[model samples]
Target: MSEHAPVEPGQVLPATELVRDRIARRWEGLNERVQAKVQSISGLDRTPEVRLIQQASSAGTVTKRVSWLRKAADHVHAGAAHLAACRKGCAHCCHIAVTISRAEAQVIARETGAKLNPKAGVFSMADSEDFGEAFKQATSGAVGKPCTFLTEGSCSIYAHRPLECRLLLNLDDDDLLCQLVEGSATNVPYLDARQHHVASVAILGQHQDYDDIRNWFPQGRANDTPSTQHKAD
Candidate 1:
């Protein structure tokens, strides 16, 4: 089959199906790994800080969730070393729109000592007739506004970043494709369509709605207090 050939309705592509299956299996193991990690941390140390870590890990705090996601991403990356191009200091893809659940946002807020504003930076492209143009407009202002957590070209809250950020793994060889100004297309392998659903379930034990990452924290600055007015794009 041609690499660019379209699959007909009701047809299943072998490669696509295999990727989906692999992601599904990895997602299924997240809970087990979380438990194992928590147990190891709890048993290997007996300090007060370690005890606090154990408690938080068992309760599925952002720290534990981040650890689980890192492990899961690493497992998937290990199998696709030839396809993955994500690396530290490569912040090209960070300019795009990022949405996250309320739970995840609250965690970030707590960790960063920032106020959580539910309505800030809200936007929806569901009604757009021209998706590309709509996306461009929606993200135009954010092109240079690196994620609030980004400092010195690195994610300051890397471990506690949103699930949307966690799932972005580029499968193309050209890093330029990740640039906001670049029009080139890039491959995305090992992507599970149900990733958001799984993330919501794992984080909040059910489906949770999302908002833009920029909206979660207060405007004016990363650690600023939230305002009463809502900001939308």
Candidate 2:
């Protein structure tokens, strides 16, 4: 899921095969145009993506890199706008885990003056099998909770949100399957933006570990962030 890093004890992502399998299943159902677009995105060169990251790195700011990611997301969204389930005021995806790098958390904390939760590692999507039952319980408990920055059915930090949040697009035709409910599963189809995820990791730094957004802005509110006048729609 991350760009690059030396494999560490608990950092290795779990369920890679499962995600690929799911992508295959989703691919089988996409419309021809959508299928062609997905293939085009998948067929893009990996080297150029890394080069783009290097260029962003040379710009000397994580925000710039993240902004580039947002633009990349916009391009993706534009191509699939007709079918993407994601739209303003529809944020069912925000209720689940949202990962961000430490540097991203720092940027958000600095910009919004939001006190970070300080608790780390517990909410990472990486295989937390080593953390035992506590991790499992926390993962389950986090599923239906609204993000700290979610307010009035919108994200308070939409302009400066994390790459994980930016690239999370539900390719379904509508929001029905994206709705969250306990004891039920959803078959939402999303692009496998692994190349971009890797680029994101590279831009942020390979050494930085990922954590959930709740851990980054535990008590922050829409009003606590940039004044309404400054917030982006």
Candidate 3:
């Protein structure tokens, strides 16, 4: 009965398909256990029309996607704005050291044409500084730094922005929602960060070997080759 219900013209759908799609893309590479999860989740796939609506909502449009996540985009933007407002032209977020997974780095490099210079792969935070100490410092002591994709005063690949960026929101100073509504604005509702993270992890975790973008690439050592040994004295 739930399978064939007639979808309304502009009605949004659940995110089961979004989960399924990602699974499909990375399925073969996943382990047997993860493959089983992927298959199980795929069984609950929603219609294509509804799936697109959810994507459109998560991207920015509130009126397009499923009901639950409609305001998600707005809230994320509001939060990001708070960190951005007083820090105008700050580029603080862009200055911190960041590590991207090989896959994600490949995506960014491919999209932006910014290659990981094999010769210039190493850069010291002390010498090759960008903005300031504050920007360089990790947020809440979290690992990874500013993304390599960040450049100048803005993002080069804003359209294909990261999931974190997509969910961030900014509230106006006068906007009472900043203080009044903790989650989701009346004009623009959004998902709580906890919920967002949980959902993302649950879905993405279904694919084995799919690493965490946050920790996929370490900022400093461990992955480096034996440089000193290879160098001539």
Each candidate's number of clashing pairs is: 1, 1, 18
lDDT for position 55 in model 1: 42
* Top candidate by TM-score: 2
Per-residue C-alpha lDDT of model 3 across residues 129-186, encoded as one tens digit per residue: 4323433332223322344343434454554344454553322222111121112112
lDDT of 1 by residue, 5-118 (tens): 332211222444554454355445554543543344344322433343334346646556645544554343334344344554566555555666566676677766667875
Candidate 1 residue pairs in backbone clash:
120-215
Put the candidates in lDDT order, highest first: 2, 1, 3
**What TM-score, over all chains together, does every model reach?**
0.50, 0.67, 0.33
Clashing pairs in 2: 3-198
Q: Which candidate is the best by lDDT?
A: 2
Candidate 3 TM-score, true structure as reference: 0.33
Whose TM-score is higher: candidate 1's or candidate 2's? 2
Where model 2 places Cα greater than 4 Å from the true spot, the runs are: 1-52, 121-138, 184-186, 222-233
lDDT of 2 by residue, 1-233 (tens): 32223222112134456544544554464666456656655654455445555566676677776666666655544454554555555666767767777777877887776787677545333435544453444445456677787765566776667667766776655444455534544456675667777766666675655667776677875454432221112
State the lDDT at 184 in candidate 1.
24
RMSD of each: 13.6, 10.3, 21.6
Q: What is the Cα-based lDDT of residue 197 in candidate 3?
A: 43
